[model samples]
Target: MAEQPTRAWYATLRHLWLDERDARRAVPPALAERLRERVAASERRHSGQLRICVEGGLPPSYLWRHLRWRVPMPKLVHQRALMLFSRLHVWDTEHNNGVLIYLLLAERRIELVADRAVARRVDAQAWSALVRDLGEALHHGRFEQGLLQAVDGVTELLAPHFRPADDGPRPNELPDEPVLR
Candidate 1:
């Protein structure tokens, strides 16, 4: 009898996340090795899948509501609204050249948005280097490490600012204002 074709990477990841015991068992060591190899090889590629989503949105609110027959609490409802907005506006910069890979597991879709300028600047060699590094990391079961490296690269390029704290001010320490004539 012939062996079954291997499942896709995303499918494997989803299965792992969902705690599918059978799927987990079916995942061969070779498949895991291949995934690691692919991650390493990704460094050569000029593109990357930068997946961003609201963490609490996992399983999705609509599905949860349908199952529960009522809306989720406000805290759970909007846990990461700002983070989602920032992903769309702040992290997405025109100067950066690359493809944006958006994977929405809830909707079961992937989107590829490309930035031409960054692509042009990042030669095949540099891209390959990144892929290789990523592959090695993934092979070692270090997905978060690879992601952090990618994010760090983008953050360094963007250099976004944060508001500095007012060293002299305390809420109740303010002086009274004089009345105007």
Candidate 2:
């Protein structure tokens, strides 16, 4: 793991102020539907599974862990993303090519977690670059554009290894909707 930056002193209060409503506002129903369509379309070209999760804030449990364990904010956020990656079953795909694009609204942090199959093929710097690019868009409140580009980016990365021989519909191992929380 990369060395985590120190936690901001005001991080707790910031998280407390955000909630599911913020997530919903950031990704409204129409935008969520668009993202779902993008993911579905991307899946049709490859065997990989993609999941997008936008969270307004860290859960209380993670907040408590941060306080007690003195975990850096970045590490804590990454942990939350990884936990969701597992809970959402992004790692259970037939090709082991699942990818999770996660966003924390309160912190404006983005974490991309790829299953081992995809991870081994892609470089860590590539993942970091994707997250950084998405972070720039999110910082500018270009949520829809950012997510669409992210889906396209992830699809490009996975297509080389997972593309199907034919254009027939691929098995969808996960829901396409962006999880708002």
Candidate 3:
């Protein structure tokens, strides 16, 4: 694996200043509800699960690792996404096609984590391009639009490999609501 790029000191301070309130403000209740509905609708088209997690800042442990080990912020953020993927049980779906769309508000960074089956089909470059486009929208404060596009992007990626048969709804292995932390 490649080494994570280290962030500057100011970035650490910025992360320390944010909390759950910042996350809530960025994605308020109404928008979150809309995103949840979007995820639900998107899931109906395929046999994949999507979990959205918007975190305001890195927890102390992540920060500690970054500060002490000079770990790159991107890697740390990706690690957090993977941790949530497992913790939220996104990996337990029957088809092994669950995906996590994780946004770190403090860093204005997005990470996508895919289950084994989905990862095998989608290349890393495709995910990178999707994240880059979503980050641009997010940097402009278009959180709702950015997240919607992200969910759609994941759906598009999964549909080719995991589309359901007979137009019937697939089992929802995970909750649709976007988690704010």
Candidate 4:
């Protein structure tokens, strides 16, 4: 006789496989507000537009599925972030220095996608380090602090390449608030 899937396996799958729209509920309002404020402040410091997105779970689609329980469903956080990078228009910047900091709450996964302008100057290793550090904080439930640190890192990284002109104010090309999905 074949053995059945264990309770722990089902619990793990539930945590990572939930796709309800209410997935956004996992993020507390206070944390979202804090992240939004941080992004707003960070955007003011550099020419690059910075956005943080928190997603509860990825929607069911071919792009976001993983093999589990004799089925190929549920997407990885990084894959979803890549899709959002384009869908959210994070690339629509004058200098092409927009950045998306995406977080998957269910899996506690973090992915950072930088537009070509910024990616050329900042190495992937730098981004990996930021994501790794931020993931650690998020793993510990330091949602607010983790996001603030990530925003600060972006500000520091992009400050040199995307600084504002001294002559006149540059119009904010992107929205300052973080997006939740």
Q: Could you tell me every candidate's TM-score relative to the true structure?
A: 0.32, 0.92, 0.91, 0.81
Model 4 agreement with the true structure over 18-89: per-residue lDDT tens digits: 643433564567766777787777777778988877776655442223424333222355667888888888
Instruction: Return the candidate ranking by lDDT, descending.
Output: 2, 3, 4, 1
Q: Please provide, for model 3 over 151-172, each residue's C-alpha lDDT reduced to its tens digit, 9 standing for 90 to 100.
A: 9999889888887757565557
lDDT of 2 by residue, 1-181 (tens): 2233234436777898999999999899999999999999999888899999999999888887777777778899999999999999998888889999999988889999999999899888888888888888878878888999999999989888887647566567899999999
True-vs-predicted CA distance for residue 134, candidate 4, Å: 0.5
Q: Write the per-residue lDDT of candidate 1 for residues 40-89, one digit (tens) a residue.
A: 33322322322322121234343354334434333332333333424454
| Model 2, runs deviating above 4 Å | 1-9, 165-168
After superposition, candidate 1 runs with Cα above 4 Å error: 5-114, 153-181
Best lDDT among the predictions, by candidate number: 2
C-alpha root-mean-square deviation, candidate 2: 3.8
lDDT of 2 at 75: 93
lDDT of 3 at 16: 86
- Local error of candidate 1 at residue 52 (angstroms): 5.0
- Ranking according to TM-score, highest score first: 2, 3, 4, 1
Model 4 lDDT, residue 177, Cα: 70
